[model samples]
Target: MSQHSENTPILEARNLIKVLGGNRVLDSVNLDIGRGRVKVLIGPSGAGKSTLLQCLNFLTPPDSGHILLEGREVNAGSKKELCSFRQQVGMIFQDFNLFDHLSALENVRVALMKVRGMSKLDATERAVAELKRVGLVDRAAHYPANLSGGQKQRVAIARALAMDPKVMLLDEPTSALDPELIGEVLTVIRALAQGGMTMIMATHQISFSASLADEFIFMEKGRIVEHGSPAELLGKGVGSRTQAFCAKISELTGEADGEFRS
Candidate 1:
């Protein structure tokens, strides 16, 4: 993993609250994500992990809160500001989100060309480099329909990386993939973590989370119930609720206790 000074936080959220249809989905959430560190958000379904990420990316503006990227506030109300913030904070969705008609290269290149306003040649070169980084260079010409689920997610990751984002937000990245396919995507993600890319991920892959995450934040009822290193959060001293949650996740993922490996 990339070495980083503990004092510098690349992204921070303060009192982030999001309400949808008269219900609070996120409640006074706060976090400081250090540069080059991997943070794993773990919780039961509908625990607001996805909503918090959406707020961080400005995909769904929070009802009330503030987000800071490299110490500058993200102004969600302004379109230009929101666009710039999004460029710095990339998002990887669960569904892959690749355009069906576009080749993997085009899917990655189009964003570089249109959003970053690069020339087609420049965008193509950058796109290919990102594809190579994600181990998808050989499949650059394949369309979404022609690629496997894992390949498509890698393309999506490549597309995000082409933006040169400071932070990546992944929401249930491997949930939709077949059991066999999940490994490929997880491998790519582990490589990214090892390369020191700052990331916050929500996933059901408890083993991967335990092995790779620098810190774990467990959410419940839209609040962070526990936040600490894997050993602390999964250790014997934690509350029963936290322990039970981790046990359930471990049971489901077939990961033994204290199986962390970086």
Candidate 2:
């Protein structure tokens, strides 16, 4: 990439607004994500973090406002344009949205063949590599029914990775996993971060996120209540919304909130 492109945010959301069932789910939210950055979204259940992520990917189209990819505004209304845009941006849901009938490898390979028009051999090769990346190569032949929750989610991540996305938007990626299985998925995500993947994630894994995220964006009532470096917002003695929320979370989950720094 050129110097200008390298400096620009890989993704931007400007004044994003979204409503559902007569409620403003996303209220004029704005965000910027630079290359190789990790941003974590934290808030209560009804705080609209998921809605903001959905709108960013146009999964749930916004009511108004604009989405810019690499500094260029996107035309979300055009199917062709939206398809092209989505190819560059991946979404990982809390629930592993895998096809039950397809094996792990097939689940990852289908999108490459259908969307990118890759041949069977090439798609198979790419899918195997992705499955290996997520440490699920041994489970490649297994169907969703046969795999554990963590394995299924790994398959989901592999499917998304096959698209070669520029940015990843993950909404509570571990929310569906059992306590014992959460770490496996998180390890994969941590490796992705180490390898310079640009990502925005909404998660309740406070300590884990605080330890890794470049920024903590706290949302409430469909709006961003606070945003700053995790160290500043979550450091000891910081009187911030993120700190208060993390305290409450640490109380409930029994995980210390002190890892937000370094």
Candidate 3:
């Protein structure tokens, strides 16, 4: 790879397509995200935002597409390659996928010991540090059942961060939380963004995303309908799909137009 390619996008998805049950969900999607940049995906429910994220990580492998990391195409045919790819591209789901039997620390520690072959002592120390990063160190002994929605989500973030991924794919991370609990999770995400974490997040938190995202990508009917910086897309009279969608969301959420529109 050339130095320019290495200097550009840290991750790329080219012509990604996925069909399920005779219906095309992700249609020829293309995306590029550079290191330390944050992009937000916005669209209606079932717009294939989740599918795109899953496909990028090969959790739900695309029927046909190319995913490149640092300008090199991903080859997930080998189990070892897939495992390494997944570790590099950490994923956080809407529902906190913590192990029910493990405490917060153990939940973060398990993958390190199992996948990375870290010693138990090393994994435990790393887990403690990650939990502290997410502000959940005090709850390290609590299981998912005992943690609040926000706390569980924090633990999930910590688990992913523990791997030191090159990119983080977030699929509606706050969608499961109650209204009062959403801010805490968003705060953690905001901190990550400020700390230069690369992220591609699919979310409906338009106002929050517009404020933080380097770009807003709008998908509809399994395709990217619009893409641009938040100011370019959401500024008054821009007349973009993203702008209109955000307007509708603002109406539904009862936020003022000024909040979602620049």
> After aligning candidate 3 to the native by TM-score, how far in Å is the CA of 14 from where it should be?
0.7
lDDT of each: 0.89, 0.92, 0.93
Model 2 residue runs over 4 Å out of place are 258-262
Quote model 1's TM-score: 0.93
What's each prediction's TM-score?
Answer: 0.93, 0.97, 0.97
Clashing pairs in 2: none
Candidate 3 lDDT score relative to the true structure: 0.93
- In candidate 1, where is summed lDDT lowest over 10 consecutive residues? 1-10
lDDT of 3 by residue, 62-160 (tens): 999899988888997988888898999989999988899999999999999999999999999999999999899999999899999999999999999
Which consecutive 10 residues in model 3 have the weakest lDDT in total? 253-262
lDDT of 1 by residue, 148-172 (tens): 9999999999999999999999999
Instruction: Choose 1 or 3, whichever is better by TM-score.
Output: 3
Give the lDDT ranking, best first. 3, 2, 1
Pairs with backbone N, CA or C atoms under 3 Å apart (clashes), candidate 3 = none
